[model samples]
Target: MKKEELIPQYLQDELREINDIRPPYSFEEITKLKDLLDHTLKQEKQLEEAEAYGAIPKEEADITNLVLTVKHFVLQESIKDAIKQLENDIEEKKRELEELKRGN
Candidate 1:
């Protein structure tokens, strides 16, 4: 097996792990992961532009890094959004409870 084939497999495995764990983590953790993802995305774009203009060595390494970074981003966003949604739902429930308590 070549390095290229190995990278995709590793990337997929990493993403799967992230997906599996994201549901239980806190919002702050997820936010931090999102920041990391944003940084990786910037680096990935830089690498792509560099490749477009010239022949670059070690391109595979950059691509693998990008894939992992993207996986992180996907998990981070998923968890963060889920937390936000749950928070909103809780807030709505609280309001309803308060209104019922007041009988208004």
Candidate 2:
């Protein structure tokens, strides 16, 4: 999907509805989320570089490996939540589309 379509501003506004504690996130939260995403991205890049150039050193790379594993676990957990949200959104959209098709 196009970047514009993927992150529509209206959806961003809608996401704020999920935040009831301490109001919606501020720019700081956006930065933090960006940093976390970037860190995961960098880890993926390192894994690719290791594969392409040479294998990670078995002893020294252990920590990085563990970190990557833990990051992946957290990502999977987030993905599950995202999937649930997406499923609900899809159902709602489907219902709306059907209503429109029926001229309701």
Candidate 3:
């Protein structure tokens, strides 16, 4: 199935925007986001089951809030990952500069 098919229609536009950002998401990052969405859906199912079983109050089983929270988390994590990769690249460049200076 297409990666787009894995994402819900409501989230497609947002995820596309994220994927289009500078530095963009790597293929691995996109896969991770898909996995996160899958996990969130599973969790939502569990919540519904719990509510049906009277293990949790119906009012507390808020799937919309859960989905939104997960979406926010995914965005934050993707940004953090991008920042970390950029930092690593900067550090590597600094090390290469030091080596060049020593050679000169």
Candidate 4:
């Protein structure tokens, strides 16, 4: 299939897999997969309901990577937000410094 056709198909298959909340290999590894299992179930519940309303399924690859991506975002959302805030602060500081230099 063409790359354009393949990408959306891949994303859809991976998204559907979230509905299958398999147990992690180790309970101690809960930091990653465990949290995601809970979140995924919630997200999947919504997705399933949406599908019932009229959502169409798509395509996939290893699928594990897709799960991993979901887990990463769920785990790191706070960190990502903090990073964004810090970046904005840094940009503002730079602008202030430039204004100071211009006035000097």
Candidate 5:
């Protein structure tokens, strides 16, 4: 489950930023941003399952093997890219936020 499901997720230090932002969000824009965050969670769960099961190729799956390229790709590289996309969304939404304020 996303930690966001357990507790609200946002700028921890500026939570009022959350309350102040009202939404009549553009479905296209919000989905585009949310998809990035969702991808990371999906990848993480898949990585965990691969590790838990024997699905992982032995070389990348275990320390005694040659390298962990596949594991690193699934568990690290992809997740990092998703995270970066979400970070970018923070900046991308500034204009939308300004628009929201105008509605008030």
Candidate 6:
């Protein structure tokens, strides 16, 4: 099966948006994104099955909302990681400046 097929149709637009962003994703990131979507689809199927069996309330088996939440979560995590890296880089530059001053 095509790697893109692993992601549900509903989530394809989000993936495209990610691809359109600057600094295109690496192969590893693409693989991880596919894996994450595949896992999410599996979980969605399980939720649907549970709802069918009456184990979960029908209203609670909102797959659309679940997918959106996952997308939001992934975006949040990526932004947080980028912010952390920037902060670390700023600190490193500060340390370099201090060292240069001391050496003069």
Q: Sorted on TM-score, highest at the top, how do the candidates line up?
A: 1, 6, 3, 2, 5, 4
The clash count for each model shown is: 0, 0, 0, 1, 0, 0
Q: How well is each residue in 11-65 modelled by candidate 4, as lDDT tens digits?
A: 4554454334333223333343446456656655665565566554532332434
Every model: Cα RMSD to truth: 4.8, 13.8, 9.2, 14.2, 14.8, 9.5
Worst 10 residues of 4 by lDDT: 21-30
- Local accuracy of candidate 1 as per-residue lDDT tens digits, 18-102: 5665554566656655665676566567766767776555656577666856775675677567678779879999999999999
lDDT of 6 by residue, 16-82 (tens): 6644433244446555555655665676677667877888654445645466567656655654555
The estimated TM-scores of all candidates read 0.50, 0.40, 0.46, 0.31, 0.32, 0.48
Question: By descending lDDT, how would the candidates be arranged?
Answer: 1, 3, 6, 2, 4, 5
Task: Give the winner by TM-score.
Answer: 1
Candidate 1, number of clashes: 0
Error of 4 at 10 (Å): 36
Q: lDDT tens string, model 5, 11-104?
A: 2212333223233334453454355335545655665688789887654434312122333333344445556666777878987899999999
Give candidate 6 misplaced runs (Cα > 4 Å): 1-10, 19-61
Question: Evaluated with lDDT, which candidate comes out highest?
Answer: 1
- The C-alpha lDDT values of all candidates are 0.67, 0.55, 0.64, 0.52, 0.47, 0.62
RMSD in Å for model 3: 9.2
| Candidate 1 residue spans exceeding 4 A from truth | 2-5, 8-21, 55-73, 76-80, 96-104
In model 4, what is the error at residue 31, expressed in angstroms? 16
Report the alpha-carbon TM-score of model 1 versus the true structure: 0.50
